[model samples]
Target chain A: MNATLVFARKEALEIVRTWRIWVLPAIILFFAITAPVLARFTPEIVGAVAGDQLGGISLPPGTYLDAYGQWIKNLSQITLFALIIIYGGIISTETSSGTAILVLTKPMSRGAFVAVKAIIHSVFLAVLTVIGTLATWGLTAAVFGHAPADPVWSSALIWLLLGVFYIALMTFFSVLIPSAVGAAGAGMGAFVLLTIGALWKPLSDHSPAGLAGQAAALAAGKPVPDLLWPVLVSLATAAVLVAAASLLFRQKEL
Target chain B: MSAAIRAAGLTKSYGRKLVLDSLDLDVEEGSIFGFLGPNGAGKTTTLRLTTGLARPTKGSIQVLGHDARAAGNAVRSAIGYLPDVPAFYEWMTAPEFLSFAGGLFGMSGSALHDRTSMLLDLAGLTDVQTKIGGYSRGMKQRLGIAQALINAPRLLLLDEPTSALDPMGRKGVLDMIASLRGRTTVFFSTHILSDVERVCDTVAILDRGRMVAQAPIDELKARYGKEKVVVEVTENADELAKEFGERPWATAIARGALGSIEITVTDLGAAQHDIPAIVAARDSGLARLEAGEIGLEEVFVELVGGGR
Candidate 1:
């Protein structure tokens, strides 16, 4: 437990000092602030761009639901891409660059090393998600007027869980691969396949992507989608990936 | 003394190629043991196995009386290693990195702080201001030593710690290692003979994944060392060389200009008594006579080169 905590601190410090601290939160907050503003002003912006053509189309008022929808969309697309970039080869880089040699030689267990990396990464993601979601709530409420709070918060947490699942898979792939580029290749390939699985309606409700897909519906005050199973599955998958990473790390040469 | 590290029939292979063959070794407690081998001699591989970084393809290794294969944190806790390159987290300061290392070993509070300070002072890194990224190769090597000692391990494994340093840096690091004599059992691998000659009490020379020779420094010197009796006189150098070569005690003899001759003898004492008499009888006006002793370089070259 002590080894895990110590390594966790180092990993967290690396993220902070390497500028991931500033860049990741800044990007998430950018999405949070813009999603609501764009939702409230779509009509005016569209009208300005289309000129007389907008007069013929029916314009609807933007609601908190629309803000929530935009928020989930940005989180799923841009924020997730940024997350992949930040985490693509986190473990593999250490092995390839020979940095892990120093630490792994210590009295600490290899299992603790892998666990600490995943734990600290999730902690950083949690910090960003909480801050970004709160900003989204405050701005969306102010712009679109007070709305039901339950759905908005539920959506953010579910989307964040989906991102966490992706990071776990990336971590597992990093252990299997010997280099950073190889890890990213395996992680992104699997990520794209999971996204494709969600495109099929029959599987969409149970796929890894369902955690992100059902967010907007849940945020719109609709009866909650059947997400309990998918959320459970995502959490389980992340745990299994972490376990496998630990096992493989123990036998790894470096 | 009990062996700090012991290996028997240890072997390792990378894919289809064997890197370390079946070998046996013993490193005594509290000895500055040098592992000498040329490049591709499996010195690094042997060190890795001893440190539990890699497993052998065959046989076993024991460190501090524990089977390294079954050894988990227990065996690792007893050993500290400095890799040949000694990679570091570039963003961390020396003190910060040491704190992180000590923390991994479960050290905290004043204990960790004091140990880190002592290591920094020992490595002469107390005044270094830059983060690890800005440090030169030599500084990083010093920090490597500091981290290796942070745990105060019973068996310290250093893989070419001074192989990459400049002359002054090498001397500094070597001096630091020499200072640790009798404190911890230091097992370092290097092809540099001067380093082994400087600090090591015992040495094991390896070639082609096999140990060619293992013994105390002085024993190896006395065993393979050529005890040459050089005699100088005013005349009859060639005739004296012939006479010296024919002597049963003389294994080989070389005749130089003037009356000088160098004879590798079977018995230094017997030849010492006979050579003087021979020179005096020849009336060659004997001027100088001295015996030569071997150093680690010759022992290493003879063993390594002959093994090939």
Candidate 2:
């Protein structure tokens, strides 16, 4: 317990001292705030430039739903990339710089090191996700004067699970790959493969990648397509990956 | 007497290459035992095995009375290890790093705080408040020592602590090791003979994964050292060399240029009394004669064959 706390505190302080931690939150918050505003004004922007050329072409009315959809799209694509690029090197840097030797030499168990890093990252991701969601919510309500028609509870559940799955999966990848570039490459590659898999009609229900993509669908009042098995399989796979990392670390020479 | 560290028939190999081959070692409590070996002589491997960082392929190791294989945690808790290259989180300050290390040993709150402060002072890193990334090599090495001693371990393993430092830095680390002479049993591995001479009372010389010699410094010197007399003769060098070589007290004799001869003798007193008579009978005029004690470096070279 003490070891876990120590490692967590150290990791937390490391994130706080560096720029990577703030970069993700800043980028996510920027996207969250601007996403809704842009969605609300996109038609105006389109009309302003083309309005003088075309005699009259009135566009369809935009609502808070459109703004929320924009926000989700921004998060799923650009914001996830920002999160990956920022947090990808967390464990890889330690391993490459030989800092892991110092920590492992202590009385701390190998499992505790991986677990503490996972917990700290999970907390950071959760806090950032909440902040982004709240910012989008406030802007969408103010701009459109009404909340988007969706099951708020289900949307929150999906977003929270998606954030957790990404953090866990990234942590596992960071441990499996020795170099920062290798880790980031593996994570990004896996993400791309999963995203492509989700696009296939037959695999959408079983694809772990659907967790993040389905958030906007849940927010748009679409029924969830029974994703419990995928979530279960993903969480189980994350557990196994984390365990494999710990086992590899135990036998590692340095 | 309880041994602080003991390894019997310890063997370890990476793939087809054998690093430690059935080597045995016993370190007593409160003794600074120097582990001397050339590069890639398995010094780090032996230290890692004893500290529970790496397991041996064959044989047994007991540290602080715990079996290293079955009781790795217990063994680890009782020992502090410093790698050849000490690395720390660049994001952490000195105090933060020490506290984290203390917490790993189950210390917390005021107790951890007090120890961290004391260790920082002891390591001479009291004023450094910036992150470890800005620290000089010497500061990092000092902090390495501080962290290694955080738990007040029964045995401390240092793998070439001063190998990477400048002369001044090396002196500082050596001084710190010297200060802990009786507080903790230090088992440091290095090819630097002067360092061993500076602080170590017992030494074990390893060569090619085997123990060449292990004993008290004085005992090793006395056992393997050959006493010799240097004599410069005016004439009849060949006859003098033959006379000295044939003497009962002489172990070996080597003839030199300018009618000089170096004679190795088992009984110095007997040879001292009989040398003049032999030279007089051979009618060789002695110009100069000198006698001195043998040095450890010579004995080490003789035993280990001066490789590296």
Each prediction's Cα lDDT score?
A: 0.86, 0.79
lDDT per residue, candidate 2, B1-308, as tens digits?
Answer: 56888999999999999999999999988899999988888998998787666789999988888877655456667778888888998888999889888888888889888999998997778988889999988788888988998998888999888876789778877887888888889999999988888889899998888888999888988999878887887788877888788888888787657657888778888888887777788777778777766666767777888655
How high a TM-score does candidate 2 get? 0.85
Clash totals for all candidate models: 0, 0
On residues A1-254, what C-alpha lDDT tens digit does candidate 2 reach at each position? Answer: 47778778878887788886778889878977886788788889888879677668787767777777776777777777766666577677776786887777677787778777877887887788778888888888888788753543356556666666666667777777777677777778877988888887556666467776677787676777786876786677667766776777666655
RMSDs, each prediction? Answer: 3.6, 4.5
The weakest ten consecutive residues by lDDT in model 2 chain B span B67-76
Q: Can you give the lDDT of residue B92 in candidate 2?
A: 81
Q: lDDT score, residue A246, model 2?
A: 73
Please state the CAPRI-style docking class of candidate 2.
medium
Using Cα atoms, each model's DockQ against the true complex is 0.62, 0.55
- Candidate 2 local accuracy as lDDT? 0.79
Query: What's the TM-score of chain B for every model shown?
Result: 0.84, 0.79
True contacts kept of each: 0.79, 0.56
lDDT score, candidate 1: 0.86
